[model samples]
Each structure stands twice: as structure tokens, then as C-alpha cells.
Target: MFPRTLLLLLSLILFKTTHAQLHLDYYRNSCPDVESIVRSAVQEKFQQTFVTAPATLRLFFHDCLVRGCDASVLLASRNNRAEKDNPENLSLAGDGFDTVIKAKAAVDNVQECRNKVSCADILVMATRDVIALTGGPSYAVELGRLDGRVSTKASVRHQIPHPDFKLEKLEAMFATHGLTLVDLIALSGAHTIGFSHCSRFSKRLYNFKSKTRIDPTLNPAYARELRGMCPEEVDSRIAISMDQTTPQTFDNVYYKNLERGRGLFTSDQTLFTHKRSRDIVRLFAFNSTAFEIAFVDAITKLGRIGVKTGNQGEIRGDCTIVN
Candidate 1:
């Protein structure tokens, strides 16, 4: 009793799902395909400029990994963007600009990476490039994405996982995006190249108890930075990121920190205790070959959180704030 139009639509849906298979490079159908076109176009621009695209992509991942790729962190504050360098948080020695601008620089060194890819795809790919430029793995990114329009400093306030998360809260946050603690730490490893803002986790710097402090053996230089940022009078509610060492790189320095008992955040430290994930952490820290493979697996998994490709959802045009 179905109308011919309805029957045809149902048949097409059956055909598409049954005929398609998911690959890391491409998702099935209109949403994903549209996203892919943009990603590719932007990547080409970067290539033309002789700039590698992966490092910037890493930064986008850093921004999004914690709270779902909201561009609030990148939009650059009114005063800071015009005169100050924004990537300050990305490195203890950054060129003094927003990391996304660093990504844009790479693309500009080539052309408009954004024009080639969706704002979403360029956002992540450019950040990844940021990570690679440092020393981390240049992870292969999946394309075909849309930008979000509703990110809030508030959302950044509430959902962005702290460098100091314990296992349970860490797991819960990652789970929101279909990730796990293993994913959380691995993603947090993106921090290896970036510097911390004392405001992010001032408590750990000022009042960490040895029992609560995961890495009692932090680098002396790192300790100095922490002390300077927090000052003795600063309150605990301050926020900071964990990858003060190499914020722009995607290499195993983060794992290296984990190995040295120097990981600044509880989130990074949690990897050593989990029964299931500890090994992956050790694996990444010691074996670059293994870490690269594991990082790809984890990042691939991370990108898929809550997204509906292949009938899950549509690609948006922007990535800064989710509408």
C-alpha cells in the first residue's frame, strides 16, 4: 500500500547502506562526500605553498578533541588577535599567535586551505599539521566534515577536559564522544607540543599533594613555568593545558613525558594505571612505530564521535561555534 515515491526512497536507502562500506579515507553518501570535496580542496592549497598540512590539522584536533571541535579557542580574543600572538598556549616558545592562525599560516604559505576544504576539515587538518611540525606522528586524517556554530566559552569552560582529570571523569568525557580513557590520554598526548596556561590547572601547580600529584618528577624548567604562571596568590580554578613541552608537534614526547613520570596532568598519568590502556601508553612512549599506529587508530576513533556520516548526519559549513 506504499506510494511509488515512498517505495522508491526506501529501496534507495536499502541499496546505499547495503552497497557501502566504511573506509578511513571516505565516508558514504552526500554528507561525507561533500565534506571530502572541501577537505581535498584545502589540502591542495597547502601543498602549493610548500607547506605541509598535517601539523595544523593536529591543532584543530587539540581544540576539538576535548569539547568537539568548537572554534572558540581559535577565534582569538579581540585584543589578543590583533596585536598578540595567539598560539602562545600551543608552545612555551610559540611564534606568539593563535594555533589556528598558525594553521592558516601554513595554508596561506600555500593558498586558502579553507577554500579547498570545509571549514571543519581544514580546522582539524591544519591543527594536525601543527602537531607534526613539532615531533609527533603526522596522523592521517579522515575528511568530509561540517563546521559547528554554537561553541561557547562556557562550553569550553565546562566540557574541555582538564590536564588533571582522574580516570573516571576522563572516561566519562571521552565517552560523550564515543571515546574511552585510552582515547582520552592518547588525545591528550596532543599536548606534548603546547604550553600550559596556569589558569587551566593552577591547583596542581600551587597545592598538589604528592599523593594526588601523578608526576612527582616534573621537569625543573616546567616547574618554573608553572610557578610563574600561577603565582602564589592565584586561585585553584585557573585552567591550563597539558602539552607545554611541544604543543604543535604530534610526536611521542607526550608518551616520553609519561615514561619519565613528568606528565603534568592527571589525565596523562591515568594511562599508566588502567588495566586495558596502560599498555598502549607504554607502547606509544617506547616504540615510535607502535605509537604511530596506535595514535592513528585512536584518532580515527576520536573523529567519529557523535557524527552521522553514512546516514548519521549532515556536514555543516562552519566549525567555530556549533549551531
Candidate 2:
């Protein structure tokens, strides 16, 4: 058996090897204009609709949460059972996929960048643009991730946090990704700009359990409004903004809403009800700058989770297919 000191050195060497290939300037020589090319393409899609911004942002988070930020969510398996096909991801908007496809096409059009840039990197860039264009901080995203080759539907099962998850469950889920309670609260703020299908949150408005009663934790007036929008046993396809106030903007209003019992998801409201996380929620509710800074830091760390670097994965020529 190897000595303890030798084992420690070996572990460090392995970690370094896995992460060594990912650098901010990985494309400096091969695709000098990759960012500009992707940005322009995503902007064109942004002009098409308001949904694109949140959709793209959700795509990035889902991509990272399930199988790391390797663009596996974009894959189209021949079996029609890729990660995106899972029921949990069915709510993910198509506009997000369109934005990334357009951006990848733009990259391919560039002379030196054709088939050189990874879809994973394009995803990171588009996510950054989504946040910036939505009036959030425009922080730098580190690049050089490789496209994942596997995207099984089974892989997506239980990977993302459910809307009904409680505070403890949410904390445990984020902890799996090396995220903290603060990260969970800050990242949940992404709900500020997105829409959710009635089916996703109807339980809180209708009979939460076997009893015919609305969730008491939810604001009664808001529950009535949601009930109108999503009548019991009606069309589940009806949608509602996760944040009713300034739904299109990306800000601390989500935290403020949580304080008012207007949080759309059970997991969201639990942050305020749970003693451990309530103080942090109050802090962000009153301080947009603090929320912004924490969000930027958390998302940056999230983007790095389980990232594939070096020869572990390939730079796929197409975002939808392994190559």
C-alpha cells in the first residue's frame, strides 16, 4: 500500500490533471473571436422574445445540475430518451435550445472556429449574456469545458430540486454539488425571470394533501389569484410568472416576495420559514447589491461543478449530437 503522504500527493495530481485543461483563454489562439460571434447570435435571438432570456438561463442551470455544465441537455439521442426528454425537463422552453443552436451555428461560420469550439463553452457564454441582458450583473464566465457524450433520460432523474422540496431537502441537494445554503437561496432567485406551468405549482393552490385545503404558508390572496389562473383539474399547461412583480427583471424582488408569503414554490417559501435560512433571506430581501454579489459568486462556483476538462470529453461539432 502507498504511504499516506504518497496517497495525498497522488490525489492532488489527479485533481490538477482533471481541471488543468479548462482555462479562460483556451480559445485565444484557435478561436479568437468566439465570444463575439456567440454574443451577437444570442442577441439576435434575445430580440425575438422575452422568454429566451430566462429559458436560456434555466437551460444552463439544468445542464449543470444534472450532468455538469457539459451541454448534455442539448443532446438528441437516437432513442428519444436524452436528458432533455425527461419529464422533469419537459418544462424547459424550446427558445433556450434555439438560442444555443443559433450561437453554435455562428461559431461554425467563423473561419478558424469551425468545429473548434465546444458546445459547453457556448452554453457558458450564452448563460452570461442572458444574465447581463436581463439587467443582472455581467460577470466573467470561465470557459474551456468539453461537450458530454452521454445524455440518458435516467441520468436526469432526481438530479434537479423539485418545486415542492423543503428547506432541508433543498440544502442537501445543493450540498451534493458543493453548494451551500446561501447558494441555494441566491440561485433560487433565478425564478425571478422565469415562468412555470400550472402543473408545477398547482398543489400549493389546490388541495396540498388529501385534505381540500390550500397551503397556509402561501398568501391567501395570492393563492386565490393562482387558483383562478390554474383552476383545479383544468388545463395544466396554463403558465404563471414565478415573480408577479417585475417578472421580466432579474433582481432581489424574489427574496422580497418570499418575505411577503408570495413565493411561488414551496422550496422558495421554506427559505423564509426555516430558521437557519430565514436570516439570509431577509438580508437579500433588503439588499439588492448583496444578493447580486452572492448570486455572481454562487453561479460562478456552480458553473465549475463536475466540469469535464482535458481528454475526459470531446468538443462536439454539433450541440445536438455527439461527434
The lDDT leader among the candidates is: 2
Q: Determine the backbone clash count of candidate 1.
A: 77
lDDT of 1 by residue, 27-146 (tens): 333233433343454445444442233334444554555445433344334444311123323332222223344433343344333233344455555545544544556655665544
The whole-model C-alpha lDDT of candidate 2 against the native structure comes to 0.86
Candidate 2's TM-score = 0.92
- The pairs that clash in candidate 2 are none
Regions of candidate 2 where Cα sits further than 4 Å from its true position: 1-21, 210-212
Q: Model-by-model lDDT, in order?
A: 0.50, 0.86
Q: Least lDDT summed over 10 consecutive residues: which range in candidate 1? A: 82-91
Q: Write the per-residue lDDT of candidate 2 for residues 230-291, one digit (tens) a residue.
A: 99889999889999998989999999999999999898899999988887788888778777
